[model samples]
Target chain A: MDKRFWVLLGLFLLMTAAGLLLGEARFVFANASLICLSCIGIQ
Target chain B: MAFFARFTDALARLRRAPVQLTSTLLWNSYFLAPWLKNVPCPGFNCYSCPLAITACPIGTLQHFIIIRRVPLYLLGVLGLIGTLFGRTACGWTCPFGFLQDLLYKVPLPKWRVSNRWAPARYVIFALLVVIIPFIALEPWFCKLCPAGALEAGLPMIALQADLRELTGLLFAVKMVILALFLLWMMVTSRPFCRFVCPLGTIYGPFNRLSGMRLHFEESRCQHCDLCRHVCPTGLYPPEEIDTAGCIRCMECLKACPHGALQSCATGTSCTERSHA
Candidate 1:
């Protein structure tokens, strides 16, 4: 696999794990936040 | 031969009388101003745009974010269209992209952005998704959007009281930017898709993984620069075939007389259609 894929995979997995540990609503909100950040510039 | 067949299908759709007129009206009103009333389409057409027949999907998505509602109906609508068309919305349906397309028709000098600029989309994507929702209290994307200037700012300023009193500074700045971009487009073809547009940023990654894709048979390529020359997005097709920057506008396909490139859905290849 590409190096960038591993990096992205790591980040996604880390976020997902954190969300699962944190709970459902927060996880959804966090995922939404990631999506939002991805939508526009992250600054 | 296979390439010509796909181009023919696209051309046929373009010539379809009802589709042609409706798309033309949608494309024209997108920039010209004043829609008949409120309609909802799967892509961003500012609700505030005078001639808008649709509410922006991004705006509505933000609404769901704020209200904490699931946007069941809106998601259903967006999802249904997305499943069928993917980034076809960017090419065919999006008012903002259409505006950029029109601007690109102007005659002028232009430059192609570097791949270093590709990261800028992710930055825009982050800002639109994270900062706007968390910081700004309104439709954050709309506030600074030239699309909004064409869609909402012009008409709302005319029709509404408080909006009328507002100074033209912000709107003027946006217009100047739009004019500059249009000039750039005349020269460059698609500077906005290449360097700007957050929605394009969003839909772009999806295009790579979408059922719809640009397929390349590297063997057919004679190292000729024709496809690269015709590409408005200025993507290096040989080096990076599936970059997220591709808008799938198909100009390269049209420009290629060699039948090298094609728009394909899934595993379907022009060379193997009979087997399928």
Candidate 2:
């Protein structure tokens, strides 16, 4: 792999860790579990 | 010996079918939703599908936009996948893409979607996923998405008859959009992936830098354009092998008679000078 590839991998990994620390996972999970009527094209 | 040979031949003919089918089943396995919905699915699938186990990354991304939060976790997961295999998920995992592949198999005339439309994906993503949702505080793309209509809207309405009460002009519009796209699929190789999928837009650029990449040996190539015929995204492999447009379906690799195109692996720098 090139230096560029490693740089991107680290960047994404850091983002994921930061997001997790910020509790975005819980936010995503909480939102995802709810079936929004708008998503299924319902009014 | 004959049986072993036959088995190998059958598997070869099957190619990506088995993996694609397995992925389609696993992602929409319904019962797995409780544990998996926290994570974003790599391909374009509607998380609202009755059987969907994981959240649609595009849909989740829109929710974040609507809520005025940065989608760091979802983007990280998607970015990691893009870094790993590029748009491989579009080829082998997307249930919606699988449906298109199956529809295209009908004995109908096929036409290639033009490369000119490639930028349309970026436009669509920007408008529906980010701009509109952020402005309206609503998931606009999900409202119009045919995949959502096919997997979630129709099924949910059909199963829960009471939902029909909520199905109004907007629902009819979604159905019409779905019908048009379905017809479009019969004559096109991958119209949605090539020109419309926001998830594909997100992953498309990574094809150039992904660990799993395409390597073309120009020294042996006669430019027969056989790869172009087999490519799901209509990419001419010689010049456009790993561009922002390539899904890394690898059909070009198998179609090259001269063995000029090969899938290069991670940790190995492709010595070929021409490729990006």
Candidate 3:
């Protein structure tokens, strides 16, 4: 581990926090909770 | 006596078997928590699996792309994992990777995918998962994802008559893709992780920058080739320990009889010879 690791950790933490504030987790749930028909390879 | 010896050899040679098996069960334990769909696990699982509990990171990323939204949460979560442990998740926690591991264990001669074609996964990440979804307003990768086919498509079609009626060319294509990979994994080592996985694409670059590291002691090395022999990704650890191609399976660490490969995380002292 070096400065790069720490720097990136902080960067990603901020990105996650920002994503949380942006309500992206809800989007993830909405998509993931339901079986995605497209993902199931159905037309 | 030979059968007993073979059994003993297999037991002693087990690497990440416990963790991998446990993770596969946990990931597929849908009844544990459907609410965890919002959270993404650190592997390439298909969220659509009947038994899957959390979101698939690659699938989630693709959905976000299709919807014209940035998947910051997914990306950040994956980035955190990648920064801390690199591609260790692929080796230890990925259900699909475990499948490949099991497939390669079948009694057969084995071959290796070339290191030169490793960069092809990046192209897959860019085109199939990202660019195509954004442009076409479809999760194109998901439509053809082998993991999705194995985990959800085949099962859904098998269990539901309506789903069977709905199956079409798209499902057949995904099945063929899945079949090719299944056959390929039997003859080679982790061909999908090495040449196709987009999640591995995100984590691969972080190997050079992750908190965890592989420490190579040059003084102890006789270049015995044991590490490379045990490596599922077929990397020669001495020369390519933390290369983007490495999934950080730690078979090298376990297989080095001379103890040349040591694991060092943020707290451990690998300052002198750490690959990262």
User: lDDT of model 2 at residue B246?
Assistant: 81
TM-score of chain B of each: 0.77, 0.91, 0.91
* Per-model TM-score versus the true fold: 0.69, 0.92, 0.92
User: Each candidate's lDDT (Cα)?
Assistant: 0.53, 0.81, 0.83
**Residue-level lDDT for A30 in candidate 2:** 81
For each candidate, report its DockQ versus the true two-chain complex: 0.04, 0.54, 0.60
Better of 1 and 2 by lDDT: 2
Tell me how far the alpha carbon of residue B237 in candidate 2 is from the true structure, in angstroms, after superposition: 0.5
lDDT of 2 at B28: 89
Of the two candidates 2 and 3, the one with more favorable DockQ, higher being better, is 3
Ranking by DockQ: 3, 2, 1
Q: Could you tell me how far off, in angstroms, the CA of residue B119 lies in candidate 2 after the best superposition?
A: 1.0
Tens digits of lDDT, candidate 1, B75-180: 4444334433445665655555665566666655565666677677677656764467656655566456655565556556666676455545556666665567
Model 1 chain B: which ten-residue window has the lowest total lDDT? Answer: B267-276
RMSD of each: 8.9, 5.6, 6.6
Report the C-alpha lDDT of model 2 over A9-42, residue by residue, as the tens digit.
8989998988999999888778777886776899
